[model samples]
Target: MAMSSTCAQLCLRCRGFLGSKTSTRLHYIQSHHWRIWTANSKSLSNGLFTNGSFTSTQTRQRLKQHMCYYNNLTVKYLTTEAKENKNADDTVRSTDGANLPQMPNTTALSIPENMNSLDLDAFNEPSALEEISDEEAVTIPFPTIPPSSTSLRDYVGKSETLTNLVQLGVDLWKLEQRPNVGSMLLRLDFSTDVAPRLLFLKNIGVEDSRLGYIISHNPFILTEELENLQTRVNYLVSKKFSTETVASMVSKAPYLLNFDVKRLDNRLGFYQHQLKLSASNTRNIIARLPRLLCGSLEPVKENLKVYEIELGFKLNEIQHMVIAVPKMLTAKKQKLTRIFDFLHNTMKVPHHLITKFPQVFNTNLLRLKERHLFLEYLGKAQYDPTLPNFISLDRLVSLPDETFCTEMALATLEDLYLFQKTL
Candidate 1:
């Protein structure tokens, strides 16, 4: 304990007041062979205290209180420089000039990975951090020097922050959407930025499982102002969405709050007005497909033309179909056209019938054709209610093969299966 404490005091006094951790590290790295640093987490504050940079006990105490996160942080300093004296005694002189076992010299040196402000030319000479004695050897009781390793924890200084993020199911790499993640983690104050955001997310009712997806995809959430975020959430609630519903929207579309509220309001208005939908219908559409706000309006507008002009659906029918299945608006242009052609041309379905069962088009083309062919073979492909044994377009596409055959087709599952196989 005494030797380690002595080493800590010596390192703090010799190296601590050199500005940021980056400059301090560069100074040591250039003379890495001579400087064996302390691993104490609290060494920086201690260094400032000893060097008279922080003179007042109250000022020092406040600094300590603010930067106390360094407490209990064990930092490993690794340096490698090829040894010149292989036959030299395995010893270094301690701060008190005691003989200590020398740290092994090697071929490569590593700057602390999280040090963000490195000036490689910070130290042109080794006198800044003087070696007390080069000829004598000393040893101090210190934690076993860890074997060489690179870890997420090395870059992310505080283990608890990482633990909480991992616990929340966040992928550390996903947080790299922001540049310089290692530096950010080292400098990020958890109390001010990270914790409050996490708590705010929870208080807003984002689910635990969804937390990972939301945060990993949108790391800016950690840095966004709490008041601004609250305003966005409030704006959503003001639009008649419940707090719980807003959480669902935010989780699914993590960037939803990233949009301006006026733009958001304009978007909501666009969807409602463009579709000629009721305000309630527009809200329902957003509830069902939160990503609706994120996509470009061009494709949506184009498809509206496609439905009314090319597909020959009346404007009113288009609105009704979109309300029934809002995703229909976002459906692939070619596939939607193909499905509409098949329903209107091949199956002789009326425009109103297609509107009545908009979800029928949601099924793939092959399934629709295969089932229709199978029904045709069985002589049961009737759609008119007045005709005998009518088959709804929905039941045709929706039911499992066996259920479709037994209930709708009045044929065996084997028949349907065999027909499908032939196709």
Candidate 2:
């Protein structure tokens, strides 16, 4: 048999009348034989449409109508099947694939039998997407601005966690929030446990070389680490680095200088006193050092020291100081000697003043003399590689009006100097 005849026989035997009809339509659509199918029915020669015996136009019209009806019916049936499957899927709800309690309509208030016993009666119904009312909204608590570093513990305090974190230099902001890291931080054993996380955060500020340098090197950000930040700051100061170099590094940090004036003064006084006196006296002051270290002191103390030295009045003796209120340091005699020795030798005080003030000195000085001396000391500090390279006086000439303060600049430089020398 020919290919067409054999195909027709197989369709009739396997699929009855419907199979033959579908096969013919498939064959016509696939073969681009639309014109042949719609041709004359009388063209069906010898009862076989493939032969010249079939040629009637009426027969072609009937066959065309049958193919169109069959196609439409098949599409309708498939669409209905899909809809049924979707409806079945919508019935599943819980993790177990069990049916959920669903509303009959948008307006019906009848609660589902399953969820009726639960505490989610208010949320049982689907919530509207639009803002229903302020009363119905969920309130997301805003994160509290972390208390300034002054209120926090020192990285090396009783907190093992904080010490480890400070050593590693981790960024606190980048840390992934554990199940409830913030809450845990707030309520943790602050005297012991909290320091680690905070110190870790401080380290993170240090590690952000681009921005972290600003924070890490910043007196404000590193207030907590001031007592312990000897190596890094000393290295920078020893290189004869300028204040601008240090300032530029700190300008990029994310924190502000939030050290408390009164608190920091007390702490610095306690430390400075111990430094001037014998080592035996140091033990008495060491007990309270942690309290001051963990508080805001670095920035305020740094700025204040510059003002005190520049003014030529003992900071502890000044009548009305910004951060200090006179009579703060009890061992003023010893403290003044130590500061004088430090300024004269390591700082390279002028030859004229060296011979004049030789061993003992008084805070009272002629006007502008102390300021002049301070500027000169700052200059030497920047150029001297033997000490920590802090700030270059040259850079001060270029600072903006808003960011630069001659007094504060001097103070900062002085702070850097003292910090570099003695930590």
Give model 1 RMSD, 1 decimal: 21.3
Least well predicted 10-residue stretch by lDDT in candidate 2 = 319-328
CA-RMSD of model 2? 22.1
- Looking at model 2, residue 157 earns an lDDT score of 49
Q: Residue 16 of candidate 2: its Cα lDDT?
A: 44
Clashes of 2: 45
lDDT (10s digit) by residue, model 1, range 1-423: 333353355456435432355335533543342232332223444434343345556655644542222221212232211142222333333235566445345324344455433344445445745665644324534433223324454443345566677777878866654566645554557777789988898999998789889878877777788888999899999999998899999998888877778878988999988888888989999988888887788888888889988998887898888888888878888988999899889989989888888989799899999999988988888998778788898888999888988899898988888888888
Q: What ranges in model 2 sit over 4 Å off? A: 1-180, 183-275, 278-289, 295-297, 300-307, 315-423
| Candidate lDDT (C-alpha), each | 0.71, 0.39
For candidate 2, write residues 1-423 as lDDT tens digits: 133453344445334423443445444432343344436433445434664434556545655564554344333323433355456657554246876443223222222333212122333355466455576554745434444343333223444444443454534443323343323333445445444424544453433334433333331333344433434434334434343443333234233223344443455455555235333333233222223333444543453464356535443333222112222333244445455555555555543433333222333222122333444545633433245744332233334423433433445544544544542
